[model samples]
Target: MPERKLTPNEVSYSAAISACEKVGRWQLALKLLDTMPQISIVPNAVSFNAAISACEKGGQWEMALSLLRQMPHVKISPNTITYSAAISACEKGGQWQLAFSLLNLMPEMTISQNAVSYNAAISACEKGGQWQLALSLLSNMLGIGLSLDGTTSGAALSACEQVSAWQPALALLDNMLSSQLLPNGLHAGSAASSLRKALGDSAAYELLDKLRELWEDNSNSNSNNNYNNYNNNSNNNKQPWEDSNNNNKQPEVRLWEAGQPVDQQLAVPPEALAAVFDVLSDVPGVIAIFKPSGVTTEEAVNELSQQLARQRHVSESVDLHIVSRLDHPTSGVLPLALGAVGSTAANWLEAQFAGRLVRKEYVCLCEGPSLGLTGCQGNVSTPLHTVELDGGRASRTEVSPIGRQAFTGYEVLAGYMPPLSSEPLLPSHDGEPGATGHADEQRPEGPELMLLRVRPLTGRTHQIRVHLASIGRPLVGDLTYGAKEASVLSSCPRLFLHARRIELRDLAGKPFVAEAELPHELEEVLAQLQQVAETSPEDGHQS
Candidate 1:
């Protein structure tokens, strides 16, 4: 039988061009587009759109514009999709001016501009560092009564992040929450990025904690109501947190204290000392403490300073400065400096961090069975960077490649495969008051637990969390990154990371080391896991 070659028509050619576009073969797409005329098939708007999209994905800005310009010559009218793809091509190619020009031309061509068109233009502005222009577009959209979605808000946040405009970023975040729009990873990341630039590391972390608390309060209330409504008609109407096996057990009180103003919160009570912190070492000019989870490093420093003053009979003038910081939910060793040491000691301590002279070691319970990780010991050097999103727009934080060169070395201490629980978990990022998530699509399959000893070679914002998530093993109880739903299923109530050891040198280059044991929450979680294993050895399988 002789095989016959079917003639390529508009539909077939459009599909071929679309296939090429998906795979980012712009050149082939263009070739296929040109071949349509040779085969006597007049290219339609769909064909041009697919070709332009291919160029957009391939970063072929000029070719995309050329294809768009040629659309009219071929007697094909460019629609909004055609123009939007062309604009996106310019956006990706850093051709903001051209993108704006195309946007302006839409009105003259009697084509009404939509949110997609404006998003592309705003995104182009963001890429080009024209945040003012991007913001203007957003304001204009609102003036014209265009309803903003996550994408639109995300783009605006990204624009604010580009310029390190923390005030605007915070304002936008507050607006999103007040409007009951969910704040996803991008939204939080961008605001955090701006805050880090404006308020330094510790304050930024504290601010994020406050924001997350507000969102959680709102989300929990709304989600609980929704859950009650969902199960109202069922015979076994129950709260989501109620476990079947532990039906009779009293609800476990979460250790995470609701955040309060540092001024209003009283000094660390003597009876609550263990729950607050463990003093690792107290030297003349430096102090180290094991900060408990749930409290910001700044709050810990403030309270601990007062405690030190009372114990040593020193005046409050002995100003304490945070020499090392940990995320709010991260419990671990934190080093501080006494102001009496003056700027010399402060500069020296800061130098150690800047030069990576200090050794930071952490232990974390990550979501992994440790399979296909290559070995028990390995290093991850994934470029950790921030991304900002508003509405539907996104832009990477202006971290240079060099700035993002974060590195972490890890050794898997133990691997335990826990059975997947059939618990119905709420989305971790369900921060909006009224927004809901689709059922858990983040269930882990096999070995659901891994213990790792980690040493960060280079420090960046969320470096350890980012690195672990990049390697498919996000930390337990991490709402950000990929561990959201998994964290909900785990018994750990906070990010399962602890800064256990720190090695550094004091003034005059004298070497020293400080270590802190795991906090009560972390230790208790581990003890529970051990008890479970003791009772049910068949429950866990080695990965």
Candidate 2:
């Protein structure tokens, strides 16, 4: 009898692809995936995700994205695993922006983002030197109640390391310990290692000291004392990925050590619990507080709830509902509904934001005072879109035809040229030495900056930052959009945009407004600019 052959079904093809994936044979796996349809075997999500995993392990990012896009064309919907694998591939290939877009797409596609997907996207950002974005994503994770694991937490540390953000790196390690996540040897070492590269030996040792103090504090006080003992042993401090038998594997490489330019400078911020926010408004069933910069809206809410509980002399937990969220760098009027979960007060406030009945007002300081944007007030009705740029760090917001239509009305409040610093605050447009020319001259005329009162008719991720950047006047400290380097504005360590006011009608049909005053740091910056304007050569020195 002749040898009998069976046609390869989906199961057979999937198994073949899995084998290829296990062995890092990404090309073979892709070819098998392609051959399946040719052989009349329709590929499902399982087979496609397996191929993506193979590509991820083999660092085939472009192929992974292609496979992911092809799934929808074939009438196959991608699940969480599909997106996670594709994101992992992008991370391996240093395509952090692409990975972020895919993660964002999951929510739009009605698939809930899981810890795995977020972890992969964060790892990609870490690899791409988008430490700010990575930290922001980590903050978002807690808002959604996703559990942070070794992989996710370690990626955040790596991102801080990439930028030499020593303070945030240490803060993150301390956070992990407080969260009971146990800072592993790998993450701690990476933070220290990156600190050494960024700020020199003194900074790295300083970080090590902070880590030791944090470990000791947790050891002396935490109820789970056993978890604190891991840091005591010297020889057993192995990285999470290392094993006793696999001593031959070189540790993951650091990009900074490999001569890649640092992405951005990050200042060490005070702990969230230590921040004190001013009370803006105390309306019925609602209180508006001035949310400080450098903390997520969720963290602000948590801290505010604790403070309120303390003032009430209550030990039990209280549910404080956040009506709307501001970005970590954005300090603004954050409204909190003090009520039980699903209370009518919470629902009403939430409904206002959902229905776009709430009005928000922002004050921003931006570059390019000479630009015509400061000439008058008008509405910027351009539709905005978020996209992954190949030559850019993280994702960028752009004007696109298919993007969500947005409206922002703005009028220039004031404009001035601050005294030039001894060193340039913004990075030079050309990479050559002192392209800005402000760095070398005596009393050089600094870049013109303008303040604007902005009203966003539509809420979008990075709406104000992107809109302003699109009009050729990016915010002073907004490194992500169009702000030059952090050194450009040495006085302002944060994005010079503030959500000064918010207005809404209560559920009872009563109109109300909540507002936050300018932060002290912003006030100081403006004050200095005012002094410079008064003493400028362009203006007769006026008292």
Candidate 3:
């Protein structure tokens, strides 16, 4: 456009800066912002906002503040976005005091404080280990009726977790549920971690169980409401599939039988569909079950749908909608919507996942040489992209710069050393076969293993596995990502990954939480590791 004699205006320059902001090109974004004024185009708030946001993403807190100061010099007033970006930059740069100062300055400048600004400030406090300050800001935000989102709650919970402030964290969780904000795994996990730190393991587990029960009750109540609403709507709309002649008859399965011959049938036997899933929770419009390893999520859904149809005495299977899915080798809590495709309950459940309002937590056994030094807890923010394999028939995710954002946080629950190598055991003094020396004497030197509590914020495919692998700590039995380790741990049954918990909202906007205990196989593996640790010289305990 410039070559064609059409000079770029403020809009064009701002657009270029915004594009740079998305990819964290702070240098280029700042250069563009500087060039705008040189070209006689006055930089507006939009132009500065993009540049500051780019600086924020690049962790350039000083540069972001510099841009904010430059705004007033250019005769452009800062807005909420401008201040929020600057505060967020400070949060990322671990400058909690600067973040608070920016937040406090917002109101003085006649700008209304929004959730984003408060969230950034709270997160900065969280990073700074100032739980009291974080809670104070959160209380102020709530007192003023400002929007409280997951980020706001998460930051507060994290702050509390850092200080082992279990009571306040629990209160915040209760407040979240009362306010009808859906709490996901991260929120619950943070609170639980705090509780465990302050009280004990039993107390934390008890709290989670109670929470699940409370959410289940809420879901049951809302499921009834949804069923009533659906029935009322159906009666009013008079769906075409409904039989006018017989009100009690089931809806016709005309769509399924349209192209098939009368004699030729799509048969699915009742016994074949007799899936004996361990029902975790069975409310009106939702069903949470334990999906075992080796079964694909689709197969579990199909079998459950058929079983539900049989129970309802319908000739065809019900259209059970899948809200979330786990890999074929993963086993845990699987929640499914128990209604037609576009029904209120199904749509609500689908929306929770699509909007990322649902929270999922997993447990896995990860193996790596540096597992001991990887710390007791950390987060992986590596972006991931799915790539095709075997001529596009299969796919897997790998860390890539051009990929979409993905985050996975992990806490080490326990650690264990691998079994001794294949060296022959010395003969016993009593003439018995057992003569391996002390565990400390015979311990093998190889990759360390850990039991990890994992929470994946963004639900990318194989996110936990891929992210862990990217950090050199892959799941022990993950054949795809830990193929080299799989040969060594041949006794492992399958991928040692399980979706342990899930949190969601029903059609009535009530929160629903559920948990699936570890399968016997995985539990046995952990038990063996515990036994090994107990005998080892340096008991495998996380710092």
Candidate 4:
């Protein structure tokens, strides 16, 4: 450059100061501030603020602090822009303490940190995974004479969602609602689906019903307005009333369809459960429930006959377990659960007589393909048959490839561990808890693994256990499904099989869905998997 000529205008001075600040030339920026006076120009508030920002952006926090003190010396007062910018720069430098100090020093006239100011600080905390800190900042933003806009809450909620913190994520959504922050489609979908999974059937139905109501109200408003316009036009033009009637009818039908409530929970209360048995007995299109026990056949017959009589279904007897439908061999039983009185006693007899149960399904955690023969990955392409403990009931199960349209889906939770800690677990169908019966089959050593999220579409007695075992993938600690493997999983403690979800149609052909979560034992096993995955990198497990 041919020796630079100086322009002494205020605009010229401000631009030079900005250029110095942009390039981290804090010393040069300060020099320019001082040099302005010698040029018969005074340092304005704009230039002073620029010099302070430069010091902060250049990592000179101390110099930035000192420059603020000199602002009054130069007869320039700091505005919100200057204060906010200084705080933001400190935010960028990870100097939150200094940023907060400066924020407190600002004019105590109920200052509000604009969107830009709070976002920078929150973003920094998020980058550091300081979730608690980030949350505190958000509360302070709202509590200290400020309200959070959609963007701030959205950022915080997104962090919570990513961490799978189900409850907090839900609360944030609720808070944003008070701000009238309408959730975009993606957020609504995620929040609804998550609420469904975490809160279960009742909550899921409530969310879906609320969504339906919202859409319904919108449609109804539109319908009412349309009908009003139609009626007005018909009256003014003397058009046919029939045309208006038809138009109104179409909209009313549409509104009703849109407004349908999703569901009503059919959960049987513990006390009303006897009422369920009453339904079983009284349901139409049924014959007498059949049950057989050697010693008490007469009493059993009398009581079951009375149960069926109360229901008004014909009373008869067959050597079987009473059930709604007995479409399959194992269909009549109460899931081999032995929850009924006495093992293989009078109640088991009723299951055999009902003869109306359609299907059965099982939920089991089979090893993934990575486990080779032991994993759920490979297909056996063969059927397997095993004898029952009674040596009288022969059980058979089949395995095929996990088909795409089979309606059976398994979501691998992507981790493994011993099934559960040594805490006492649930009882078995035989009225005894775990580690009973085989007594000698407990494993001596080694970690056991449990898969997650196994769901079955069709019900077949012992279907889940039998099918999984056919492919050499036994459940972690299933005594019946894989007796030998129970020992293998002895270290895991809990049986990894859970009846996660059941889907079927009622007698009226309407669909029904029920689900149960993993028991505490399984949860403990998953906790172990997480710990192992965290501590051991060579395993290369990413969860």
Judge candidate 1 against the unseen true structure and give its global Cα lDDT, from 0 to 1: 0.65
Residue lDDT tens for model 3, 1-543: 778999899899999999988876789999999888687998889999999998987768999999999888879999999999999989877789999999998889999999999999999998778899999999889888996788999999888887788778777876665566645545766776676666565555444444443334434444323211111233444323223553524321111111111111112233433356777765546768889999999998888877767776989987777767899999999988766654444545654454344678999987654333323466788677675443345678878753555778777666676655412221212211211111123333456667888888678889998887776667878888874534335468889999999987554334678899998998887776632242233666523
Who wins the lDDT comparison?
Answer: 3
Sort by TM-score, top down from the best: 3, 2, 1, 4
Number of clashing residue pairs, candidate 2: 3
Off by over 4 Å in 1: 1-6, 222-543
Write the residue-wise lDDT of candidate 4 on 122-142 in tens digits.
Answer: 654543445566677788778
Model 2, 1-543: lDDT tens digits are 014566668998999899988877788899999988787989998899999998887767898988988998999999999999998888767688898999899889998899999999998887667899999999998899987788888889878866667667766765666567655445666666555655454544443333333433443455465344334334354432234564524332111111222111111112322346677766555667788889999888787777655655789756677767888899988877655444444544554454345679999987742322233565566677564433122355677643554778787676666555523443223222211111122223445677888888677778988876666567877877865643345457788889999887543335679877788888888887742233233454532
Off by over 4 Å in 4: 1-7, 15-31, 38-40, 52-63, 107-115, 128-130, 158-165, 183-543
Tens digit per residue, CA lDDT, model 1, 165-250: 76776667655655556455456666666656655554444444443343334334554232111112332543222345536232
**Model 2 residue 534 CA deviation in Å:** 12
Each prediction's Cα lDDT score? 0.65, 0.67, 0.70, 0.44
Model 2 clash pairs are 425-487, 425-488, 426-488
Among all windows of 10 consecutive residues in model 2, the one with the lowest summed lDDT is 254-263
- Residue 104 in model 4: shift from native, Å? 3.1
Best first by lDDT, ranked: 3, 2, 1, 4
| TM, every model | 0.45, 0.47, 0.50, 0.32
